[model samples]
Every structure is written in structure tokens, then in C-alpha cells.
Target chain A: MEIDYSNIRVIGFDADDTLWVNETYFREAEEKVGMLLSHFETPNKIDQELFRMEIKNLPTYGYGIKGFVLSMVELSIELSNGTVSNKIISEILRIGKDMIDKPVQLLDGVEEVLISLSKDYKLILATKGDLLDQERKLEKSGLNQYFHHIEVLSEKQEANYQKLLNHLDINPTEFLMIGNSLKSDILPLINIGAKAIHVPFHTTWQHEKVERNATNGLNYKTVKSLREILNFFKQN
Target chain B: MEIDYSNIRVIGFDADDTLWVNETYFREAEEKVGMLLSHFETPNKIDQELFRMEIKNLPTYGYGIKGFVLSMVELSIELSNGTVSNKIISEILRIGKDMIDKPVQLLDGVEEVLISLSKDYKLILATKGDLLDQERKLEKSGLNQYFHHIEVLSEKQEANYQKLLNHLDINPTEFLMIGNSLKSDILPLINIGAKAIHVPFHTTWQHEKVERNATNGLNYKTVKSLREILNFFKQN
Candidate 1:
């Protein structure tokens, strides 16, 4: 798919998998949690239970370590037939805590693409995560220098995108959102009349996935890698 | 400071430092970038150069990677005597791209306090960031469950807060804004006739920083920690 990049003044990127390999790390931690849970419950059942807790707690907690820890606690109790030990709970908490310290690894060619795109378009790092964690990764990876502003937010929805546009003083039509998650990046950007580039990651974090059918009619283009963005810009 | 929790039917949270640490991460990264620039230019000069680029790009790109990368490239070119090496440029670009993979670490006790408050108040996560990044954090953190609605916005200005209240189908007076940034969370909430709790984070993110004093006579209280929220509830 081609897009006219000439008129586009600002390009907003969905951090995580778009510019770096965030989901894979998250998946690694999640898999570990799943393994821990499997010691007491079936993998499917553990996932179901945790998912139920997530849905139940979303309205009150929103997101982060507090919620993740609470979900583990809830899961442990359910899996252990109400006899979950404090050790098990603490172990889960420890794992949740440890995930935050994991090292960040960038996706291939992310730097070249960002630099190339930055020359022509205004760039923003629009990412979400625990503020400290996101900051640490940026600091460690040495990527924090490029963005003029780094937005660490709570969720990605239509309102968030609108707010970003307002803050940047840009129109949705002039903005381009690039990211991996269809649910968070593509859907929200498209809904707000902003252009979006969908870069599909091989392993999606559990929470970033959405029903594919919901992405209908969103003016989003797909790419397999970051370098494709240049081609997208050239063709458009 | 004291507030009546019983009268508060809805409690909103500011995403950045209020619930988690954000600015310190950026500061760290910025400092690192400054250090990198210092290898060729004076620290003050580097700061000035980067700040100028940031100010210029923010209005065009908003917040995130696009603006950041541009700033780095511009700085490199300026520092390199108008001749930027591909290697140095790539390094800068790498730093910009690496920001997405950062881990998410929640502020201490944020979850526990929010969980306790959720039982009594209709909780909402009112934060502004990159849409996709915020949602991913929310999902991963397991906090998405607590918020009946999650608002990821671009700015937390007065109008934005007002819009949030309107969207939630609630009155401003019935809501309380709890956050770290006095500018975005406190002032806006108070402007709309709502109560605000300012829980100052030790490190404030640059963008959300008030950069000024409160002008309006807002009904607000300042707290040092999230646990104080319980006290606010008891008093009111």
C-alpha cells in the first residue's frame, strides 16, 4: 500500500514492537508465569482464570505491576483449591517484579528507519508501560535521544490518539502511527483519521491482541519490517 | 490535606508519575544523550541545541520518536561541524529506536492503594501517552481490570479533563483527580469544580511538568504518597 508522505508533517510511532522488540520480552515473562501456573493448574485453565481476573479488575486498576501481582495472587488461590501458600504468592510476585528488570532488545533496522523517517517527518515516541520500566529501557538502549517528546500513557484508545494530536497541535490526517498491535495501534489511529502502518510481530504480548475483524476499513498499511517504511514513504 | 472519600463516586488517576515513575527515565536518557553530545560540544551548548530542536518539533510531531530522532540528527549535524558520520547518526538513531522496548515498572504501593480505593470509588485511569503503548502497559500490568473506562489522552489540560468528565457521564463535583503532575491533574480537575489530590513523585517528567504555578482557586489537596488517599477518604 502507498501513502502520500509529502503532506505528512508528523509521524507518531507506537513504541514497543514498532521500533524495538518489546513484545518478545513480555512474552518470555508471560510464558514463565504460565509455566509457574502449570505446576498447579492446566495451562488453559490458568490462562482462563487470569484472563477472567484481568477483565474483572480492569475497571478498577487499569494496568501495571499492581494488577499483574494481584492477578497472580488470584490465580494461585483458585488453582490451589483455596490452599495457595504464601510462598507461592510471593514467588509469583517476585517473578512479576523481576520482569521489569529484563533487558531491552531493539528490533532489526529500527535505527536506520527511524533516522531516515526523522529527516522528513516529525517523530514522536508514543509508548505505554510502567513509567519507570519504559524509561529504563529507553535509557539502557540509548534510544531516548531521538524523540522530542516521549508519551508514557495508560491505554491506547481513540481518546488517547486525539489527545496526542491535540498536544502536538497536529491534525490526525497529518499524523502516521506505526506499531505492531492491531488492537492498540492500527485500530485507534484509524478511528481518529490518522494514517497507521501495521508491522506485525511474530509473538504478540497476550494483552495486545484483538479480534482481526474489528480492524475493518481502517486506513492502515501493513509491513513486515521497519525498512519497508522507507519504501512506503517513497511509494506514497 | 483532607478530602471526603464518601462524596467521591469517581476517582481518576494521572498515568505518568502519579501511578508510576516516568520523568526520571527520560531525564536519565536525556542526560545520556547530553553526555554523548558533550564528547564533541559543551554540555550547556548541547542542551540548548537539543532543547531548541525539541521546542520546534513538539508542535509539529507532538510527543514520541519522530521528534526525538530529528532532534538527535540535528544536534549531531550541528556538533559535527555540518558533517555527520553515518556511524554516529546510526548510534543516535539506535537510541531513538530502543526506547520502545523499555520495561514498565510501577511506583511503589500504587496498586495496593488503587485496589483499596476501587472498592469504594468508580476508578478510572486518565492518562495521556502514545495510544498503543499505554494500552499495552495497561494490559500487561493487569491494571486494565480496575478501570471501568480508561482514557489515554494527549494532554491533561482543563478542557481535556472537562471532556473526560462529560464522557464518563459524571459531574465534576463528584469526581477527584489523583495524580503527580500539578499542572495536568491538579489544576485541570480543580478548574472543573472537582477535587484533586497531588501526590508528587520524586521525579517529574519534563513534558507534564507545570512549568508554572497554579492560577485558579481549585479545590485541591496535596499528598506525598498514594497511601494518603485512604486518609483523604476518611476525612471527607
Candidate 2:
């Protein structure tokens, strides 16, 4: 089934990993946490525990470096049986601040794709994370000019995209979303009758990883890189 | 100079204290933190340090309970000279979770005013906080029906409001903003040439405090309660 490109008036790009190097930082932070708590558990166990902590606290803390740091702190205490040193906890805080301060590293050809698309479509950044953190990254990425505005979603479920289309005063058929996460950016949009293109990031968060069966019959395109998206709109 | 609100076409309400009990919870959390760290410093000193810590980290953490909790954890480690117990850190995390899980408490006459005004004007929630947190509160408050949608700003300054108006495609004269803080909700809107009404909350965060002269000549109304707003909009 060939998806029509003529109907999409607005295009939404996901920020983390899709536009910039994000999940890589999280992986680095997780490795740092594992090293910091080596006395309590092995690196693999620590990784498993940290993932559990994040999922457990997702409802209360949501997503972002701050919440991720909080989960690491909680996991540290639990894994160490309430004996985790204050120094280790302090180091975790530093790790979060460092992540927030890290320079915005745009993924390859992100700017080119955005510049090419912005001329023909109203481009928006539809992402799920801490609003300020994402805004700061956008400002630093120097791609703010190409976007109509940023839409920070709490979650990227089907209902969220529906509401976004409704808010933007565009129909689902008139919208297209491109992102790295199939769970967050692609499947939901496809389910909602909107077009989606997957630009797979080298690293994806464990929570964002979806099963192959989930994408089985979906009518969205998956490209090896974001730059390839330009090919689809060339003759428009 | 009698400011004319006859041209107002859209209204923005600040969610925190204007529609619900927000600052009060922060204050309570502060008191709890003071108790947790009493052994390390006097209550007065602990309060001062926490305020200083939050202000210093504001640029990195922005505004929200997750950041607040992170700040509290850092302060505990600082006050204890790196010996703060893991148990105390765990307790502070609990305080933050409790704050987030708190039920939305609407201020007096909030629903009545929303019900009356939502009929005649396009209403929106203009606020600064975690996006997920604010959306969750609106969902819990049952006042979601009154708002066309929620606008979460990273900061509620003159420039932010201007951007908001521009995005909504409404002129300053066509917009009215109602809220509790003179700094965030009132002055910024007025500075942007939008009509504003002040509804004072009993407790304002120290960071939100402004000098008397800042509001000396601003042409905006100050109401004692959210209910009083209904009177001003009756003619419309």
C-alpha cells in the first residue's frame, strides 16, 4: 500500500535520537551509574534494576534527565540496601546536570532534511520529555527557525496525535510524523490514519523498543537515515 | 485610564494558584525538608539554603517537582557535608512523589467562574511547570472542559506571552490573562499589551515576588478571589 504524500500539510519530527544524539547519552549515564554502584551488584544486574526503577516511577516522574537521575538514585539505595553513599548520590546528580548541559549534537543530515521539508510543509517538533530541557536543546540545535513551533507531548500515543492534529487544526490525513521510536512516533500515527516514516536511531531506549509483530502490517516507511526522507517529496 | 476589555476574544488562566492549591503544597514540602535536615542545620538556615539551591539550579532544572526533589537531595548532601543518610534522601524522594500524587484542589468559585466565562470566551490554561504534571493536574481538576487547550511555557515572561499570542493568532488587545502572580501572570501580559487581572494567592514563591513599584502604574485589575472575575465579564 503506497501512502500518499500530497495530503500531508504538517510534518512532525521527534527530538531525542531522531534529530539529535539522545539515547546514546542515556546509555552512557547508565554505564556510569553501574560503575558507581559496582560494590552492590554486577553491571548487568545494575542495568536491569535501573530499568525497573524507571518503569516503576514513570507514572510519578514522567520522562527526562531529572526523572532518570531520580530513578538511578532510588535504585542505588535499594540495590545497596539503604547503604549507598551520599557521594554516589551526589555523583548521580552531577551526571544529570551534565546530561542537561551537554551540547546538542544533531544527527547526520537532520538540518538538511528539515531545511528541505520546511519550505514545502509546516514542520513541528513533536516530542515527549521535559519541556524546558527539550526547548533548550532546540535552541542550541539552532533548528528552531525551521519549525512552526514545538509540541511537547506527555506521551506519543494515538490519542495524543489525534489531539495534536485537532489543536493544529489539521486532519490526520494531512499530517505526517517522522521519528526513531516505533512505539512512540510511528505506530501511533499509523494507527490514527496519519502517515509516518521511521528513521531508526543507532540506539533506542529499552522502553521504546517494540516487537516485530507490532509493525507487521503497518503501512509506514522505514528509512535507514533521516536524509532519505527528502527523496519522497522531491517532485511535489 | 480605564482599560477596555470589550475587545477581548480569548482568556488565559494560570493554573497553579489561580485555579488550584499549588504553592501551599510546595511550602508544606519545604517544611518537611526542614524537618528531614534539622540535624545538619537550623530550620531557618535549611530554608535559606534550599531556596538558594533551587534558584541556582533553576537554569538547569527549570520548574517542577522532579527538579525540586533533585534540589532537596543535593541540599541534604551539602548540609550534611557528604554524610547525609540514604534514609533521609529516600524520605525526600517520597515527599516529592506525594506532592506529585496530590489531588487537584480548586480554589473557591473556580468552577463557577469557568462555567460562566467559558460560555462567552475562548479559554486556555497558561502555565509554567512540567508539561506532564500540568496536563495531569488539568485532567484531575475537571476544569479541562473550560479550556480550549493548555499552553505550558518554559517561562511566563513578556516574550513568552507574545509568542503565545502570535501562535494563537490573536492580538494582544484580543486576549485577557488572569492569574495569581504579579510577576508571571500579570506584568508580563500587560507588558505585552494584553489585558490582565490579578487574583492574589495567599502564598507566593519567593522567586515570584516583585517590588511594589513594579505594579504601581500598570493598568490592570486586582481581584481578591477567582470568583470576583465573573463580575467583570458579565457584560460580555
Candidate 3:
């Protein structure tokens, strides 16, 4: 069955890995955390525990560098039986600050694609990251002009996308989503009867990794690069 | 000169402390932190230092219970000379979770005012707190039905208000803002040539305090409670 692009009046681009370097920094931060806690546990063990801690606190902290850092601090204290040195906790805080301060690194063809598509369709940034951090990155990325709306969601479930569409005053068929995370940006839209395009990033967070069968029969495009998306929207 | 709200077509309400009891919880949390860190500093001294630390970290953390918790943790480490017990840190983490889990306590006459105004004008929640936290509170408050939109802003400055008006596609004169903070909800709207009504909350955060001279010549009205504003909007 041929999928349709003619109905998509608005396109929501996920900010983090889809537009620029995000998960990479998180990966680096995790590695640094692993090193920081190596005295108590193995690097692999530390990584697993940190993931567990974040998931445990997801309802309380939602998603962001601050939450991630807090989880790391908590994990350090837990792993060391409430005796983790304050130096390690301080370093974790520094790691989070550094992540927030990191330069916005736009991915290949992001600007070009946005420029081309934004001329025809309304472009919005819909991400579940912290609002300030995402807004700061958007301003720093120098691509703020390309967007019409910026939505920072607490979660990107089917209901959230529905609320977003209603807020936008658009139908599901008239909206399309694009991002690297299958769990967050793609499947949720597809489930909600909207369109989605998957542009896989090199590194995926453990929580975002989905089983192969989850997308087995879902109808969406998988482009290797963002630039390739232009071909689908080019009117004949 | 009498202020005219006859031109108002949309109403924006500040969430924290405006619709519900917010700052009171923050104050209580501060007292808890002071008690927790009493060994390191006097209660007054700890309060002062924590405020200083929060101001220093505001740019990084923005606003919310999560940021508040993070600041408490950082302050603990700082005040103890990196010798704070992990138990205290864990307790701080518990404090954050409890804050997030706190029930939404609506201010007197909030629902009555919302019900009356929402019938005549489009209503929106314009807040600077965490998006998740604000959304959760709104859901719990049972006042979500009265709002047409929920906007969690990074900051409620003049430019942000200007952007909001633009987004709402309404002229400044056609919008009215009602809230508890002079620095945030009241002054910014007045500066942008929009209508604003100040309903002062019992407790205001130190950072949100405005100098008397700042509002010396401003023309916004000040109401003693949320319910009083209904009198201004009722048809003659």
C-alpha cells in the first residue's frame, strides 16, 4: 500500500537527536558517570543501575538533564550504601551543567530540509525535553526561524499527540511527525493515525530501544538521512 | 483613568500561586531543608545561602519542584563542605518526590472565577513551572476543562508575553492576564500594553518580589482575591 504525504499540512520535528547531537552527549555523560563510580561497581553495572534509577524517577522528574543528573547522584549513593563521596555527586552535577552548556550541533541536511519543507508546510518542534534547555538549543541552533510552534511535552504518547493535534486545530491525517526514537516520535504518531518518518540516530538510549516486531507492520517511511525526506514532498 | 476590560477576548492565568497554593509549599520545604542542614548552618543562614544558591542555579534549572530539589541537593553538598551524609541527600530526593506528589489545593473562588470567565473568553494557563508538574497539577485541580490552552513558559517576561499574544493571534488590548506575581504575571502584561489584574498570594518567592517603584505608574488593578475580579467582568 502506498502511503500518502499530500494530507500532511503540518510537520513536527523532534529536537534532540533528530535535529542535532543530543544522545551522544548523554552517552558521554553516562561513560563519565561509569568512570566516576568505577571504585564501587563495574562500568556496565553502573550504566544499568543509572537506567533503573531514571525509570524509577520518571514520573517525578519527567525527562531532562537535571533529572538524569539527579538519578546519577541517587544511584551513586545507593550503589555505595549511602557512603558515596560528595566529590562524585558534585562531578555528576558538573556533568549535567556541561551537557546543558554544550554547543548545539545540527545534523547533516537539517537546515536545508527545514528550509525547503517549511516553505510549504507549517513546521513545529515537538519534543519531550525540558522546555528551557530545548528553547536554548533551538535559539543556539539558529533554526528557530523555521518553526511556527514549539511544544515541549511531558510525554509523547498517543494521547499527547492527540492533544497536540487538537491544540493545533488539525486532524490526525493533516499532521506528520519525524524523529529518531521509535518509541517517542514514530510509533505514537502511527498509533494515533498520524504520519511519521524515522531517521535513525547512531546511538539510541536504552529506554527508547524497541523490539523489531513493534514496527513490523507499521506504515511509515524510514529514510537514512533527513535530506532524503525532501523527495517525498516535492510536488510534480 | 478607569481600566477597560471590555476589549478582552482572551484570558491568561498564571498557574502556580495564582490558581493554587504553591509558594506556601516552597516555604515549608525551605524550613525542612534548614532543619536538615542545621548542623552546618543556622536556620536563617541556611535559608539565605539556599536562596543564593537557587538564584545562582536558576539559569540552569529554570523553575519547578525538580529544580528546587536539585538546588537543595547542591546546597547540602556546598554547606557541608562536601561532607554531607548520603542519608541527607536521599532525604532531599524524597522531599522532591513528595513535593511533586503533593495535592493541588485550589485557591478560594478559583473555579468560580474560571467558570464565569471561560464562558465569555478563551482561557489559557500561562505558567513558568515545569511543564509536567503544571500539567499534573491542572489535571488534579479539575480546572483543566476551563482552559482552552495550557502554556508552560520558560519565563514570563514581556517578550514571552508578546510571543504568546502573537501565538494567540490577538492584539494586546484584546488579552487580559490575571495572576499572583507582579514581576511575572502583572507587570509584563502591563508593559506589553495588555490588561492585567493582580491577585496577590499570601507568600511570594524572594526572586519574584518587585520593588515598589517598578509598579509606581502601572495601571493594572489589584484585587484582594480571585473572586473579586468577577465583579469587573460582569455586564453592567
Q: Candidate 1: misplaced stretches above 4 Å? A: B1-236
- Best of the candidates, lDDT: 2
Superposing every Cα of model 1 onto the true structure, what RMSD results? 18.4
Clash count list over all predictions: 48, 0, 0
Best by TM-score: 2
Candidate 3 RMSD to the correct structure: 1.1
Which residue pairs in candidate 3 have backbone atoms (N, alpha carbon, C) closer than 3 angstroms, thus clashing? none
Q: What DockQ does each listed candidate score?
A: 0.04, 0.92, 0.84
Leading candidate by DockQ: 2
Q: Lowest-lDDT window of 10 residues in candidate 3 chain B?
A: B227-236
What lDDT tens digits, residue by residue, belong to model 2 across residues A1-236? 66679998999999999999999999999999999999999999999999999999999889999999999999999999999988899999999999999999989999899988998899999999999999999999999999998999999999999999999999999999999999999999999899999999888888999999989988999999999888889855
Q: How far is B139's C-alpha from truth in model 3 (Å)?
A: 1.0
Off by over 4 Å in 2: none
Q: Write the per-residue lDDT of candidate 2 for residues B1-236, one digit (tens) a residue.
A: 66677999999999999999999999999999999899999999999999999999999999999999999999999999999898999999999999999999999999999898888899999999999999999999988889998999999999999999999999999999999999999998888889999999999999999999988878999999988888777754
Worst 10 residues of 2 chain B by lDDT: B227-236
- Please state the error at residue B152 of candidate 1 in Å: 12
